[model samples]
Structures are given as structure tokens and as C-alpha cells.
Target: MKGIVFLGERRLALVEVNDPTPGDGEVVVEIKASGMCGSDLHPYRALQDLSRPPESRVIGGHEPSGIVAAVGRGVPRHVALVGDRVMVHHYHGCTVCRHCRTGWPQLCEPITRTTYSANAHGAHAPYMKVSADTLVPLHDSLSFEAGAAIACGTGTAWGGLERLQPRGDETIAVFGQGPVGLSATLLASTRGSRVIAIDLDDDRLAMARQFGADETINAREANVAEVLRELTGGQGVEMVVETSGSPQAAAAGLQAIAVWGKVCMVGIGGKVTVDTQAMLDRQITVMTSYTMSTVAQKSCADFVVSRNLDLDRLFTHRWRLDQAEDAYRVFDAQVSGKGAFIF
Candidate 1:
């Protein structure tokens, strides 16, 4: 099998590697489509420290949609077959942990191994192995590419919004126009919440409006808090979904949140200075959500299947496994809205 290996900072090579076999309770998926996430660009930019020894060199992709190629022991035959189309969860937690027992396995007590972009072998190759427990069967109607997007971007958005619990009549502000923020805006609008989408890019703002944002604010143009206040009629937004991972955006999100409002931080950018005093004074509840659990992933898939959301529009470009390096280069440029690799 051929796959892209992350050798070091800004260094990735396409090389031939041995095919991975499924272990007990696991299954091997023939890669069909894999989406490149924003977080995946961190290592390439040297944003994430890579001084430690490499954990796994299988492939550097997490959001994968494929068909089952093989199954390992202890897995039911009906649950997975040789040709079954599926979406894989990139990170599989220790099922024995308290967090896993409560359906928050992303915060597993001991932190189980992950795939591709994380600590585990990923799907940016011809084949990838994943725990059978973490694989979700896609409906016949959903394409492999759409399934790939749902596993990470869409699922993360659903999980973040679930944490915030945005209601129908309340106004919610999403502080980014990336895939996660855009997905959140679409989901929030479907739930009847008025969405204020903020981003530095006017093109992304336009995309946000197409996805159902009631208002769009170019953060680079004006004071974000002031614009948000004006949109909300001076009451401020009821909830703030901070997905830019920018310090300024985080602070603005905090300042623009209504009294006692909930602020969910889903982006994983560098550290930001937050005003603890003002947050405490306003009685604001600050929360952060990580990757989605198996349950949340299934919920997101269900929503896509039932609601018929316009997921196909999210794909701006596609590449093959051999073009993996070019994919990263394009992502680093951030010129295209989004992209994926189809095997």
C-alpha cells in the first residue's frame, strides 16, 4: 500500500507501506474519500511540537469514508461485511474509562490511541484500520465523500452545538467561517435559531449566509462586539460558538455573549488571553468541546440523512492519495474553502 508519511515539520513523503490488518474488535476500511481538517494543518506549519518520537506512520488523514475490506475477531458479521460502506471515527477511546461509559470518550481517562493526524494510523491511504465499535454504517443514499465530511466536521459541529444547547428563539453567534463554524451555522438555523456568522473573509461570510446564517459580520471591517450587538438589538447573542481559535475572536465572543450565556469553544488555535474578571462578573458559563463521541457521530450522520443538508457544496476540491502532498500545500495556503482526498 502507498500512503503519505509525516516525517517532521513541513516534511511529508509519499511512500509504499505494508497494509494494516485488523486486530480483534477492529475492521479494515478501503479508503474511498478523506477530508483534510483545519487541525490537520497544525503539524505541517510547525504549530504542534513534533520533537517526540513519531507514534505511527500509517497515513495522515482522519476524516475517512470507505468500504469494509476485512473484519477481525469478536466482530459480528452482520455489523460489517466485506463491501459495507462506512465512516470511521478517527480516535477510539478506552471503553473502560469513566468518560467512555458516559458517552464522552474523546476525554478518555487514559487517552486511547488515535488515527492518522493523531497518534494512530489514519485513512490517507489505500486502506485504514479502525475499531469496529467506532465505525458507523452510512445509509445507501449518502455518498462516501459526504460520509467523510460528516465524521469530523459535521459531527464536531453537532457536538459543540449540543453542548451549548441553543434554543429556537435565541440568537447564536458563530465566531469563525471555517468548516466547523459553517456547519454549526447550518445546524443552528435548522433548529430555528438566528445565527450571526462572523469571519475575517467576506467570501466565507457569503458562504455562511448561504448555509442559513441570518446575519454575517466581517470581523476585519468593524468591531465584532458592536456589530453583534447591533444585530441582536443591543441584547447581545444568547450563545457564542467560538471556532476561530483566534485570541481576538475569543475575547470578542466573550464580550459579546449575553448575561449568563453559554460560550462553547470548538477551535484549537494557540493560547489566548481571556478576561477572567469580566467572565466571572457576567456569570458567564465557558465550555469547551473536543471531538465527537461514537454517539454524537451517529447523531450527525442521522441528521444528514434525514435533513438532506447541502453537504456536497462543502467540497471545493478533491485529490487522490498520490496527490496528498499537494493537498497539504493547498490547505496550508487556505485558498480553497475545503478539500478532500478520494482513493
Candidate 2:
């Protein structure tokens, strides 16, 4: 099996390794497509800082899609059978936790959940071992690349938008034009909500229009809050989805919405400073979220298929497993859009 391992200085290598075998209640998947997530860079950036290498090597991909190669004893046949196409939910929780009991195992209390690329082996390899419980069925109509995207970017956006519940009568300002933000723009528009997409790059903003943004604002060119204010007739939009994770954008997005508006933050970045007095005066509702659960993962795939969304457009770059290093290099440099490694 061929896999990627990070060796500091933002470098990675393709190495030959033994194939993974399924553990009890687990499955070994032959990975077909794996998404290169923005969040994957966090570990790579800090791996060298540790006194000693944490694991054999750092493997950083989380969004995984594949065909089941083998299933372990006690695994549910109906859920993950050999040769079945599926996406693996990156988060693996302690099944007995309260949060896991609620179907959102990813948010287990006391944080006993283990995720890909952090503590466990990730899907950047040709084969990955995952819990059968984390498998989500991939419809024949959806491509492997799209299934991989659902593992993270698309799933995160879908879950956040579903929580915000954008309506036709409402207007939403999606603060970012990256994969997650673009997904938000497309979903919000398909739901009939007027969408205003914001970004610092002209190219991303242009792509946002392709995703169904009614208005585009380059944060570098103009005041984001001011532009959004004018677009909404001074009352401001009813909703704001901040996927940039920029501290300034975070604060501006929350303050740009109409009184009592809803704001959902999906991006994980610098700290954001908020005004308590202003928040109280406006009675704002702010929510911070991450990836969806395994159940929600299935629902998100269905949501994309039901809307007939072009998840393909989000994947602007694709490479083979051997090209892993170059893929992450450009992605980390912010020179690429949603990317994937096809086996």
C-alpha cells in the first residue's frame, strides 16, 4: 500500500506500507478518493514542534471515500458490506458517551473522540481502517470525488446551513468563498434565500457567482459590512454564515446582520472579538459548528443529490496519491480550490 507521511518543513513523502486490516466492528476500505481539507494543514504546521514524532508518521487527510475491502467480526452486514461504496465519517467516538447516544458521535462529551490525521491513521493512504459504524452509503448517482467532499467540506456546509435554515424571504451573507463558503452559497441559493458572498480573492468571488451568489464583495476592495448593509437596504441581511475564520470577518459578519439575525461560524481560525453590548442590543444568535455526524453525513449526501448540486465544481484540482506533496503545497499556499487525491 502507498501512503503519505509528513516530515516537517511542510514536506510529505509517498511511502510503501502494509495494508490495513479491520479490527473488531471495523472495516478496511480501499480508498478511491480522499479530499485535501483546509483543516489538514493544522497538524502539518505543528508536527515539527513536538519534542518527538507523535506517531510513526503524520498522515493528514480526513475526508475519505472508498469501497469496502473487508469487514471485521460483529460488523453489521447491512451497514458496511464488502464492495459497498461509502464515505467514512472522520470522527470516531467512544460509543457509550451521551453525545454519541444522540447520533452526533463526533461531539462526544469529555472529547474522547479520535479523528483522522490527528491521532489515527488517515485516508491519504491507499487503504484505511475505519469503524463500520462510521460508514455512510454513497448513492450510485454520486461520484467518488463528490462522496469524498461530503466527508468534510460539503458536509460541514450542509450541516451549518441546515442549522441556520435559510428561507426564501431571508437574505444571507456568506463570509468566505472557499469550499465551505461556496457550498453555503449554493445551498442557500437553492433554498431560495438571496445570497451575498464575500471573499478577499477576486477569483474565489467569481466562482461564488457560479455557486449562486446574488452579490459578491471582495473584502480587500471594500468594507464588507458596509457593502452588505447597502445590499440589504440598510436593515442588513437576516443571516450571516462566516466561513473565513478571519477574526475581523467574524466580528464584521456578526455585526453586519439585521437585528435578531442568525450567524453560523464554520471556519476554525484566529480568535474573534465580539461586543457584548451590541450583541445584547441586537439580540443576536451566534452559533459555532464543525463537521456533521455519520447520520447527518448520509443526509447531506441525499441533500446534495436532491438538489442536483454540481459538487464537481468545488473540486478544482485532483491528483494521484503520489502527488500528495504538491497537492498540499499549492492548497496550503491558498492557490487551489477544493482538491482531492484519486487512487
Query: Which prediction has the highest TM-score against the true structure?
Result: 2
Backbone clash count, each prediction separately: 3, 0
* lDDT, candidate 2, 1-343, per-residue tens: 7778676668677767678889899999899999988776766565465455434774668889999999999997798889999998988888888788766877888788878777788899889998887888998889999999998998988889878877677999998888889888988898899999999888888899988999999888899898889998899889988887888898789778799999998988668888889889988899977778777888889988998887988999999887777788888876457999998
Candidate 1 lDDT tens digits, 158-261:
98998988768889999988888888899999989999999988888888999999999988799999888888788778899988788899889888988888
| lDDT score for residue 320 of model 1 | 85
Provide TM-scores for the models: 0.93, 0.96
Instruction: Report residue 106 deviation for candidate 1 (angstroms).
Output: 2.2
lDDT of 1: 0.83
Assess each prediction's global lDDT (C-alpha) against the native: 0.83, 0.84
Error of 1 at 46 (Å): 1.2
Q: What is the lDDT of residue 124 in candidate 1?
A: 78
Clashing pairs in 2: none
